[model samples]
Target: MTQTRRAIVLLSGGLDSATCLAIARNMGFESYALSVAYGQRHAAELTASKRVAEALGAREHRLAMVNLGQFGGSALTDPTIAIPEDGGDGGIPVTYVPARNTVMLSIALGWAEVLGAQDIFVGVNAVDYSGYPDCRPEYIQAFEAMANLATKAGVEGARMTIHAPLIKLSKAEIIALGTRLGVDYGMTVTCYQADDQGRACGRCEACRLRRAGFQAAGLDDPTPYQIPER
Candidate 1:
């Protein structure tokens, strides 16, 4: 019998992560979808995560509730800090949670070790991102190296691999690819401050990028938005 190759996919219930999950499944992996509840302002995130996991036919779905809101460093984790609507000026945006990817990938690594899986997938993009320092290709490489050295499984020759399939992809390219793979963007939420109904605020940076991507892809924008008429 052929052994099932398992992969831990870090699913944020957003556009990129959902597409990343689909890509892992397409690569013949038994995907274990992992979502982190790091005290994000968007309450709809976890709900969307559940939707994506079920819709994409993940082998298993798990939620890790680690409240990073206690830190109060980012807008996503702290309600006091306002989510910017300028669509990102230059530097890293306020939505860039401190050490978020590190913590998320660390959780993924621990679960992978327990599940006897060596593959982990993250959907970080460089091109059309919010300028999060952790989303860069260099950061992904460094994290993979750390994963190989930090775990007991790695010492036993089970070298871990961190897969960032959407790292270099533009938002339009990603949307196009995910569309071809049957991803329902309407089911996913990327807004920094989505309402309980999972409707996106069309003015935030995330919404701007996502809306632009759909336009560039020449695809129908199926995402539900709560935009005030100007």
Candidate 2:
């Protein structure tokens, strides 16, 4: 009998990562959902990630806390800067956490090594992302190349891979794909400046983009927000 291949998906509890987890399951990989609590403003997303993992039937769902607060350059971890409310038309927004993807991917690689999983899936998109350099396709490719060389599994001749299924997909397409995968958007969270109760501020850049995606897809966003009612 053939065993299912294992995949470690970096589930951020947001729409994209939750969709990626579902995608990994659909692709016949035994799902292991991993989340990081890296001192982001919207820590509530981690709770959503846990829900998504259970909903998606992941074999394991783990949340590891690492204080990236020491790296205070980004708005996500730094309280000094505010999360962007308007479109970030300027250079890399203040919310661009430096080396965030690098750090997360490194940790995911470590977990995948221990789990003996050859595939690590991350839901990073360039098209809809608010100009996060790490979300770019080339960044993912470079990380994949470096990860394969950095891990013991790769050094031992086991081929390790990083999967970014939504790298090229637009926000609307991502929403559509997640819908097709039986993903419950209500269980996912995407607001970067959500209140502690998970109600979106609806004014932050993340909220704006998420609202746009659902509008473009003609889907009612199930995410709770404070705007429409306010």
Please name the candidate that would achieve the greatest TM-score relative to the true structure: 1
- Give one digit per residue, the lDDT tens place, for model 1 in 2-81: 99899999999999999999999899999999999998889798999999999998999999989899988999998899
Candidate 1, overall lDDT? 0.94
Query: Can you tell me which runs of candidate 2 are displaced by over 4 Å?
Result: 227-230
Q: Would you estimate the TM-scores of all the predictions?
A: 0.98, 0.96
lDDT tens string, model 2, 1-230? 99889999999999999999999999999998989999998988998888899999999998888888787998889988888788767688998888888888888898889988999999999888888889988998898888878878998988888899999998999999999999998877788787777788888888888889999999998888765653
RMSD of 1: 1.1
Clashing pairs in 1: none
lDDT of each: 0.94, 0.89
